[model samples]
Target: MTPAGRATGAGRVFPPLPQHPDPQAPFATSWWGNAWIGALEGTSLDAGRLARGRAYAREGHVDTITVAPGRIVAYVHGSRPRPYRAEIRMRTLTPEDWDNFLDAVATEPAHIAALLDKDMPHALVDAAERAGVQLLPGPGDLVPSCTCPDHGRPCKHAAALTYQTARLLDADPFVLLLLRGGDEQALLDELAQRNAHQAAREQSATTPGATGESLPGTLARDALATDYRPPLPAPLPPPAHPGEPPLLPSLPGAPNPTSLEFLATDTANRAHAYLTTGTAPFPTADPWHDAVRLAASHPGLTGRRSFSRQFAELARSVDHTPTDLSRAAAAWRQGGEEGLSVLESPWDPPAGPFDRARGALITADLPRMTIHHNHLTNASGSLQLRYGRDGRWYPYRSEPGRDDWWPEGEADADPVGAVTGMIGS
Candidate 1:
């Protein structure tokens, strides 16, 4: 069924939409109050984000739209996009014009209703059709539901959007044309022509060029013409980046399995081997399986988080009394796999606060984990590692409170030798 048309008074000025208050608000009335309402129908259906909605958007889920013929479609979010069988023939209006119309309505509701009951405009219908507003072809109510705290098909956010869009429709009326398909300027021009024709009929027998006005004369009066000027190009600034560990040299006291030149050379050799022999030089696990296993081993490293070089300071602060403890401390100062390996693997059940046999690596349940040559400690500290999915490696830390294993005295000791002895023991 066709909806009633809205009328615009000749010479009435259409005001702009309201300004948005918070720039960061996820959903704002102003943002959703745009002319292209149907474009938003399928945007909320991002599968990746919706799959992990709880951990991702915190609680908000998405809604889908139902498309139909010759009517503006309704959209709401939930498990899936559903159709609201009931049809609402709609029109859009600018917020400013809408407010003015509402004020006039409040002053005289009967007059507004009478005009709404009048014949609908062809321009509006054509524009609305072009905008892709259509009756959704479906059987049931299209309720948007989210797995988030909001249980209904449409949350407060979507509902607010719906109500606000409706209110915008009650104003300037051309916004409805904009919603239907045409831009604001286009609709306004059409309406302006209609007004001009009516005025011409009312004042018949007028000759052309009676006013002798031209477009350029009007353009001369425009604010843009008065303010027009070219801008100067600014100077380019030097690139600056954050403080990071030196990749090539590594750091003083850091682990170095081999020189970078050697490692790069080895990687190049491996690539050549793969290219020539058609065999993988390095053992590559399935990314998904590797990520799952890596996650299980650490259990805590879920998101894109990193750790800094605070462990170095902690190591420097420890005091040594006994000779064995002194040796462990010196080994720790050396900062590498050899130093940390001297610190015994932290047992699943640690013996003391400073267990001679248990360290961070042992407690973190690191299994068959390859320590990079640059890792600060192999046994007890954080590991800057990567997941299978991400492009780069990040830092992972052991759970706090349980501390034992690497001692100040064992820092300088041969941890690999100690581990070998343990294998024998």
Candidate 2:
């Protein structure tokens, strides 16, 4: 199969460049979950880094190799210790077994384990064990034996591969999982089977064995008939206590509650509202962190839009709603020229003082926002840019040697002038 974002080349798959370059601006330095690296230990795979390694593999880069159960084996180019190739161990599933496994996985969702039985390498090996799968060491698991007499962990070629894979996995998780034998659906299926036999046993015990008979199919069907589902009882009125006032009122001597205070209290009632709901859009740093933390906590979620949707749902309330730009910006870190692009796309020309007024056309005020730009370079040469704010024209151009962004000074100077400077310099 072709690597993501790339076309097939002579029947061989080549890796594609990143589709989205900038993840937008204000969100650049998001440190959402303290455990992005730490948490990998609890799962069979480092869904995050495995993703990056897959991208490296696509480009045909020698730095990284991805395998089953979301394992990413990276080699150091010339670190020191060299690794040896293990005996080749190949297992081809029989047509029947493969079909049964696929069918079983298709019936449910995740299926990483049943498809592969290797323990995850790296710090996440423990995580894989917890999830009940072992990511194994096989061909392509490590670099070929190194000639270096030093016996260091990895030589230069292996080290280079390791760095490259680490960078790749940092960018995409799907690629990592693909390298693993199963995808999310496959993993979930394996997990389901582990508990399934217990459920079947419970059902058998509940049935009577006298006369060697089983519950009649028709009677069993009737027991679960939707038409016979019990009707939901009407909501009960708040209970009344003997001699209690008909309705709870403001404390006798306390001042009456104001709408604003009531709204504020309402927001506080929900979980993580401060991080979730706010009238202001998420600024670059904190917003993305808040978002990734949520996604990392919940698997199978991806893309910048997913973060936007989750944040909206988590913070859905009036008081927590950002009523003004100031309130919105408050949710993010403060910096000057940096602050301007807090709620804007990085792909667009950086937001200047003048753009602030234009935000009113979309809404009375701009919510905190950030534009993400991912600059990718590989066999494929595609540019990916995503903007957060609604109205604005983003300008982009190519510069030799720079894939992620234009040089810092160039990004800020007049486009015409910047081009001239590049030519002169």
Candidate 3:
């Protein structure tokens, strides 16, 4: 796709950009950076103001920027005696858009690799757009506001801030996610959630079942070109969710419509769950864990009634309490047995990880915390963490009026965020 401002039909420009004074490096060097600049120049009606803004940015008029969810703020100096507070606001993506974006990004492992290398590949952007996420700004996506006296859409100061922010976007793609309503760790946590079942799914796919059917594979080159699903105008599998069996008329002295609806909804949900993972929802090797897994899969009471009775019977046989089953089942729902281990077990970890985690917590400006053995607890003992064997921190809340800790939420790859997220919740 062409950058907004540079698109001249047939790839011809009436007048080309001037030669750069520095051939080795130029302002807005990255394609995304150039795209940002394109958005700015494409939408602005005053070319002279944009030129002045570029000059101001080059002359170091912009201050350090603080980027938040949907805004970037900085101080830009012009001919005026006092610096003006400049802001460039972009529309923050909604949760649905973010979900689609992350789904697209996760589909291609190379996309995350590209981000790690500080490169935003066009293919990743294309993938996101295909998923209905518009990553780069279009003509009106950027709304520049400034505290300056000038009445232009974007005064020179605001434009300066925009240019600097583009450089920032060029340097790190996470900055763009921030502008679009996602933070790095939050996005990572969510991506982790989506991938929580990924391994089990992959294993389930490759491992044959009772029938021992071989799972066939196809090359992309062959798959993309065939009509009979060989290379492929492939069959659309099944409908995304289970369709209702023929609408049944209720008979007297039989089940009511409400009961039938409940059964139908439960059946559809189970099928949807299966379709979602392409397998059962997170199976495990341990029988107890598998039982807990089954319980978690049935969500509402109507669906869970049978599982609840089974769990009660099993809990009695195992000499475990109902509360214990509830807690473990919650963990199983979050990710699987790994999540359960994070909750129920703790082992000694090397100090190296502890020290690194301590630094991150400090950076997050969390309440003062002290690490003890494999746990990190705040001074007041209200919030806490337990280091898992898997090198992730799991959040726990203090049992009110008691001296014990119980797991609260999913394990976080980021130690600081694990506890910080609890605070927000």
Candidate 4:
């Protein structure tokens, strides 16, 4: 039998769920879908209502579901002839909050890559949370309503609709993004555009003559003539007093003495191999995995702290601040090397006067060419100059607990002059 359609609002129609001879699956296969169900079950006060809702969902009572930013609407078949209308509304993130969330996502390529692969990593969600944008709905966020006479916050009909929606979310994670005020294509396009812009800026920074002025004849010739290969370090001499046995250094009051000795010997052997061969014996392409392997072999270092220390050391080697390393560590812990790479990857500065200024800085023969949001970072990644909305460039330096782009100097309209002055200082 064909179910009747009910007109809810302008051009919005809710069609009843098709009846099947066999009962449908009770829950979604995906973790996200299960998370939705968990959220629903966690909120309901009455166990009977939830049980009935599960039955209603399994029996295919839910109709075609419609989801929009901040709203979900559906119809569920019940004992009554007319279907019950159900709607669930979630408070959407504010424009500023969304901007901040997007900024965080843009900073890391892995976040977008994970979403593109239909996997929403917890790291991305945590980053959004830190940015004051709640991507996932919490207990109080899911506001449910139903036309059914039941006084429960989410009547069985509404619960059934939500359960079905979770199934939809399982199929397409972008539905959550849609609920968060952006369509899939729109978000992808925005990310692509941002990535491309950043790539272009990097290219411009690298290209020798892309800027208006060409390098000086002597300098260009000298640069071309210079040998770029690094000189290999001299091998260490054999340990003094070769006849004496090498002592295993022991930490005072250390536990597991034998294990510590083995670990120390293994570490020294590996270091010697790396020094002699100029390569790792068990080389891994992934630094995170390499660190984990090292930690596994060591007695004291293990778990998140070990991974974090390795990540911090790597970040420091690349001149990134501790704050940046902390974010990277969080991403790595949540999503491994892919997450770490995302955080490490430089994002393009937002389109504005900043891009032109950065281009000008590159033209002026400045080293290091990363443009992040309104800030232009030097090759060292320590010094930064930010372009303010007031049409002035302000200087900044990396400092712990001061992650925000706080300007330290007088603002100047001239980007090139501002950068030059900062560099000179």
Candidate with best lDDT: 3
Q: Sort by lDDT, best first: what order?
A: 3, 4, 1, 2
Q: All candidates: CA RMSD in angstroms?
A: 21.3, 23.4, 22.6, 29.9
Q: Kindly list the per-residue Cα lDDT of model 4 for residues 67-186, writing each as its tens digit.
A: 766677765777753466577887655667656776778778899899899988889989988988877877767888886679897789888888778867776787777766666666
lDDT of each: 0.32, 0.32, 0.68, 0.62
Write the residue-wise lDDT of candidate 3 on 1-425 in tens digits.
11111111111001112323442455787989888888888899999999888777777778656676666666575665335657777887776788788788876778877877888999999999999989999887888887666988788988888877777777788788777767676676666665645655676778777353556898888867756643658656766655432222347888654335335645676686787678975445576775566445433211211233444655565567655766676666555677777667667789998888888888878776788778888877778887877777888787544756656766788888788778777
Question: For each predicted model, how many residue pairs clash, with residues at least 3 apart or on different chains?
Answer: 45, 79, 5, 1
lDDT string for model 1 (150-240, tens) is: 5433343344333333334444353444333334343334444545555565555576545644436455457476665878788544223
Distance (Å) between predicted and true CA of 281, model 4? 78
Residue range with the least summed lDDT across 10 consecutive positions in model 4: 1-10
Candidate 1's C-alpha lDDT? 0.32
- Candidate 2, position 79, lDDT: 20
lDDT of 3 at 349: 84
Model 1 residue runs over 4 Å out of place are 1-151, 160-176, 180-182, 205-370, 373-383, 386-425
TM-score of 1: 0.24
Candidate 4: global Cα-lDDT?
0.62
TM-score of 4: 0.44
Candidate 2 has a TM-score of: 0.23
